[model samples]
Target: MIVFTLLGFMCATVVGIIRIRDLFSVVMLTGMFSLLGAAIYVVMDAVDVAFTEAAVGAGVSTVLMLGTLALTSREEKTTGSSRAVSGGLIALVTGVILIYGTLDMPSYGDPQSPIHNHVVPRYINQSPNEVGLPNVVTSVLASYRGYDTLGETFVIFTAAIGVIAIIGRGRRRRKKPEDQTEADT
Candidate 1:
């Protein structure tokens, strides 16, 4: 029930994002969508995932996008209807392919699922002795998935640097005009 409500809100947000020409409004709607996704994760008992979604999706990404908006136009430029149609078609095809790919997967929480039969048990039983951690979640993330976590951190850091570079470049361009005007004076 709660999940469905969140999903509905997410759908509405997506629609709003698509219809809005204002980039700032779109960014805010995207952040709201992320918050709704985090809420869904929380309701599903994946608190760690919820925290990551909230922090990265809603917090950091929103701030970076707003920073970008600061250096650019507030409204998105209109495109041809043909281009919009082609883009929509591509998105529809991609979504269909993704859904088809998921059809073969086991249903959620099926006991006979490979992860439940194998990986989950191993992590649950061996993590304590092998990793020597009091908390299973901490051991799994910090030990077993350490490399994956590190990769995620590096990706986020790289994205942040890229945004900072773009913003800095914009500032430099703005200042060059001022510098030239001062020289003229």
Candidate 2:
């Protein structure tokens, strides 16, 4: 029930984001969507994912977007309807392809699923000895998937650096004229 409610809220938030021309309101709605996603994750017993979503999705992303907004317009410029139609078509097709791709996956919590049958038992039994970590989750993330985690971290760091660079460049550009006039005086 809670999950359904959260999903509904997320859908509504998406609609709000799409219909609203105010970039600030759109950013706020995006953050709300992320928070609702985190709540759904919590209800689904994925607390780690929930924490990550809340922190990265809602928290960091919102702040970054707000910083971006500060450097730009508050309201979004209206684009041509043709561009909107094309974009919507692309999104719809991509969503269909993604949904089709997931159709072959095992159902949630299926005991005979590949992960449960092969991966889970191995991790549960051997992680303590093989990885030397008492916590299976930690062992899996740190040892078994170390490279993947590192790659994700690297990507996030690079993105953050890029955003900071862009924002800083804008600030420098805005201040250059003032600095030049002061120097002349």
Candidate 3:
């Protein structure tokens, strides 16, 4: 019930974002959607994912988007009807293909799931012995996929630097001419 409610809210926010021409409102709705997504992640028992979503999606991303909005128009320019129709058609087709792909996916939490049958049991049985970690999750993420995790961290750090650079450039541009002239003199 809770998951369904969160999903419904996310859907509504997405629709609102699509319909709203105001860029600020769209950003706000996107943040709300991210928060709802984080809550769903929590309910799904992915605490790490939920934390990351809340911190990055709802917090950092929202602030960065607002900073971007500060340097841009508050409303989006309207596009031609034909362009909108074509974009919508593309989105619909993509969504249909994705849904079709999911049709063959195993049901949630099936004990006999291929992953459980092969990968999970091995992790549970041998991780402590092979990886020397009592916590299976830690062993898998830190040892087995350490490079992947490091790469993800590096990407996030790089994105943060990019956002800071963009916002800093905007601030520099906003400096008064007198300030520049004074510095030059």
Candidate 4:
């Protein structure tokens, strides 16, 4: 019931964001959406993912978006009705296709799922022995999937650096009158 409520809130938030013309409201709603997603992750027994979502989605991303909004327009320009209709139609079709694609996927947590039958068992059985780590999860991620982890870290680092650079440039462009006078003098 709680999950359903959270999901309903998320859906409403998405609709609100889509309809909102105010950039600030959209950014705030985006943060709210992230928070709701984190709650859903918690309900789904994924505390690690929930923590990450809270930190990245609700925390860093919200701040960055607000910084961006400060540097840009507060109100979104209205597009042509034809363009809006076409774009919405495309989005609806894409969503339907995505939902259809998931229909064939195995039900979550099914023991007979191929993932549980094959890859997971290997990780659980062999990780400690092969990687020589007492923690199976650590061994699997740090040892077996080291490159994948490294790639993810590198991507995050790059994204953070990019955001910082963009925000810094925006700050520099907004010079105070006193600073401008000092420079002129």
Candidate 5:
């Protein structure tokens, strides 16, 4: 029931995100959707995924998107679009193939999984003795995938700084005090 509700909320959020009038509201809805995904992850006992989702998805993404939104006009300028029937047909076929690929995936908790044989076992035995960290996911992300983590952090930070740099600088459209005073009159 909770999972279904979460899915419904996420679907509504996706629809709203595409159709919303206000950019800020769209960003807020995206944040809400991320939070709901985090809650679902918690229910599935994926604490690390929930943490990443809450931080990057809900918090950082929303802040970054809102910052970018502030630098641009909220109202979409384009009124109409020509048909892209070829593109739409290609996308539909691709989506069907992707869905089909999911049908033959391994059942959850099968003992014969390569995860049980190959990677997970080595991590279990070698991790505690070597790194002394109980949480293997953290150790893998910080140590094994260290370069990727560094890249991801830099990407987020760069985006945030870029947003700040562009929006914080003086722009021509900024309202002068006289304009506000005249408007108030």
Candidate 6:
């Protein structure tokens, strides 16, 4: 119940951030949203994921956003309510559809599922010898399917570098003041 409540509040806060015409409120809501996501990850027992969420999403992201706020406008001008209504309606429909799909998913930790009886055992036994590697996943990734995974990893690294470069201090440029009085001499 607490998890659900926090999640609901988080979602509402994200919505508020999008709708409210106040810069302070938006920043606060964004922080709240990040913290709530961290909390949800904790509740789900994803400790590693929760740690990253708390650090990157809750901590670093808040600081980055606040720094951006300091660099930009503080007050947000109101754009009226019709756009809000349209956005809310679309989001509501999407959420309902996602919930319905989630309801059809198999229960977690069910060992009796077909996954246990499938071709996993064959792969587990033959993977190391067939691919000439100890770690099955590594063998599958680097030996049998190296190029595809390398491309995916390269893409992620490229994206991460792009984001970091964007946030990093750019080249310092100095512009000389215009010579106005010299022409009058």
lDDT scores in order: 0.90, 0.89, 0.88, 0.87, 0.83, 0.76
Off by over 4 Å in 1: 79-81, 160-174
Pairwise lDDT winner, candidates 3 and 6: 3
- Tens-digit lDDT track of model 6 for 38-91: 888788766666787888887887887788889788887665666777888998
Model 2: lowest-lDDT 10 consecutive positions: 76-85
TM-scores for the candidates = 0.83, 0.80, 0.79, 0.78, 0.72, 0.60
**TM-score rank, highest first?**
1, 2, 3, 4, 5, 6
Point to the candidate with the largest TM-score: 1
- As a TM-score, model 5 comes out at 0.72
Instruction: After superposing candidate 6 on the true structure, give the runs of residues whose Cα lies further than 4 Å from its correct spot.
Output: 107-185
Q: Which scores better on TM-score, 1 or 3?
A: 1
Clashing pairs in 3: none
Give lDDT tens digits, candidate 2, residues 1-185: 77788889989999999899999999999999999999999998778889999999999999989988997889877874668878989999999999999999998667788877877899989998899977787888989999999998999899889977976688889899999999999
Tens-place lDDT digits, model 1, residues 29-144: 99999999999999988888899999999998899799889977898878746688789899999999999998999997577877678677989898888999877878888999
Candidate 2 vs. true structure, TM-score: 0.80
* Steric clashes per prediction: 0, 0, 0, 0, 0, 0
Which run of 10 residues does model 3 get worst, by summed lDDT? 167-176
lDDT of 3 at 70: 93
Better of 4 and 5 by lDDT: 4
Better of 4 and 5 by TM-score: 4
Query: How would the candidate models be sorted by lDDT, starting from the highest?
Result: 1, 2, 3, 4, 5, 6
Point out where model 5 deviates above 4 Å: 83-87, 108-112, 150-185
Q: Worst lDDT window (10 residues) for model 4?
A: 166-175
Q: Evaluate model 4: give its TM-score.
A: 0.78
Tens-place lDDT per residue, model 4, 1-185, is 88899999999999999889999999999999999999999998777779999999899899988987887779888864668878989999999999999898998667787777877888888876788877665776788889999999999899889977976677676767669899999
